[model samples]
Target: MPQWSDYTNGQRIKILRGREITQPQLAERCGLSVVTIQKAEQDKVLSLTTLLRIAGALGVDTSVILGQQAPRRAMSMDDRAMLRELSRAVHDSWVGLLPRTVAAPSADELRAAVDACWARYWEGHYAEAGAIVAPLLEAATAHRHEQPHDRQATAWGLISDAHRLAAYVANLMGARDLAYAAIGHAQEAAESAADNMRHALVTSGRAWVYLRDSRLKAALDLAEKSAVDIEPRFSRATPGELVAYGSHVNFAAVVAARLEKKERAKEFLSQSHAAGARLGEEIAAHGTRWGPVSATTQAVGVNVGLGRIGKALALADDIKDVSALSPAAQNRYSMDLALAQAHARQWDASLDTLEETLTKAPEWSRHQVLPGVIVEKVGRASTARLRRVSKLLGVSNPVTGGFDTATEKSAL
Candidate 1:
């Protein structure tokens, strides 16, 4: 077993560095002087209260510092290199510090900084984005810590966006738990701000996460509730262009489909479509991370739930390769295809599609979006028919059913 003392000072420092926080910074955040933090780092003996405070400051758990578990190691050389670049960018951006007497930066400036981060990140310049926004995030953290009332709500709201974006990138990079934790922090800040749009988005994002995890009922409940406060809580968007509200409706459609509530699914999908149309023109004019309300992917699922095999197939054909979507979306599309193929009695095609969906990525499993789930449903039905055919053919061993044996375990 790896013990706490097994870690060297260098290792601890590396962990601290990777966390993007400094000991002195933690001290400042915890209302302790720098010298006290220096002693703790040098002695590797942090008080429980100090550890808790530092952990909170770093958006981590206390076990992280107590060495209860080894810290998250860097991934590839690419990940390490990227982290270094990001750290450097953060440091360089903070090179100038106006006097403590100077007024803190304005919320609009921080919001602009967040926007710049997204532009660079979307362009695939991870380091540059990291550099541009790292200091801004740090400064915001410091401001909230030192001067709690200075634009407190706005500061937390913007900080939530920064963390949420980071979580998005992290999920793309395959650090799932870390991504979840980042989103959790973002939600906490958003709630602290009491900003409805941000709050709705955070809940909508979690519903998406739950959908990926195959918790359909949980996803449905959260998504529906999220959209309830759309008009009353936040006037951030027009009544029709409430993008987050549209997303909730879409998620509800997905859950309804998964639960085999064909009528409910169709109703929700139509509502989503209407909401999307209302909101679409105001948005980027192009779709966002959430697919269009009338997305063929969602339509495919609705068709499958309704047992309209031909309709499902028609919708599936219209969908482009949906692999670029998030795992939840991809799984929704793949499962629809699998179910449709099974309904059409295209056994080979159904098995092939299901296998293909499962093999795309490992997150497909951890996140519980396995296409094999629908396969199992079809497999049982096929087995009974095979047994009937075998009796008529007088064959003890019949290979009529083409279903993979593993599908038997995935029955709905």
Candidate 2:
């Protein structure tokens, strides 16, 4: 019945660890030194990466260790269901269980369906998008086998897109293995299509999977190489080519920032910005949203990843219209902004930003670790307003100790 705010991070770690996990065991599981675990449990400072690892090893969301919420599975029921369906689809494709003679949708219809799936995904309707992708994959796979050579190529491209969408959803939900498999499906489809752009796009998808799994160097290398492979002569580049190249460069910047390669990260961001300027408007290509606005938004996160918090804030100020971004991108940018505010000790503003973002995209926020990270940073200082924010995020207040079980539900 105790309130979440009643405990410090150290206390929460101890409680979560309990008698089941020893310091050495946790350290081994989290790939940290025993001393690090001890220090963290003593309320000493730990890097965000280290904290995230510990949370992952403990099989709980970061919010549990941050004392913002109880231990819980990271994925929602919908996410788990989607992962299951995707897994089954991938397995069926591998085993040749997909219907061999289903009526294939027209090329235009297939293209429209894929486009709709991407739109739904970017809009934060992840589960709905996923539902559309499963059937599309089956249909595309059938078409790839049934159509004549000329038409089959198009079917392969659509199949690649469907699997790419699957990979995107799986990665976002933290199902790494499932994402890896989905990407494999996409790569196979891309190869069958014999399209350089499709292959480059799948490479970009693989880079993202690597990034999600903490293979930072691999991600950077692949993203950079893929960008270069698809880099059209800017003067002659089609808008689609511009978006493809810019998206890879944007991802490369992200990975570089994570690796602490500040100059390299900036160079990538600049390249992306140049491509965006040429494109002259927001565009979606190969399931990625890219443009000047997208580059600027990514730059904010790269700066933050490089510990250039002030620069990140400055870049954020230039984004005068959050509405210009898709819901997913806007949520991500807001998270970066909230983190910067927290690092600057502007806790009130951070909470406000976080509250608004979570309200706007509750389900998406539930899958993210940054919200919990910001909450932990702000919790270092006790305030009545902070308690209110905690309650809003479904964490109990310390002063009151407990809430009626029936009344204590997460706003998300």
Best by TM-score: 2
lDDT per residue for candidate 2 within 80-180, as digits (tens), equals: 45666777786686555886455677778889989999999998887788878888887777666668877677788888888999898878776778789
Report, for every candidate in turn, its global Cα lDDT versus the true structure. Answer: 0.56, 0.78
Note the residue pairs that clash in candidate 1.
none
- TM-score, prediction 2: 0.77
> For candidate 2, which ten residues in a row score worst on lDDT?
403-412
Highest lDDT among the candidates is held by which one? 2
Deviation (Å) of 256 in candidate 1: 3.2
Clashing pairs in 2: none
TM-score of each candidate structure, all chains considered together: 0.51, 0.77
Stretches off by above 4 angstroms in model 2 are 1-74, 99-102, 149-151, 391-412
**Candidate 1 to truth, TM:** 0.51
When summed lDDT is taken over every stretch of 10 residues in candidate 1, the lowest stretch is 403-412
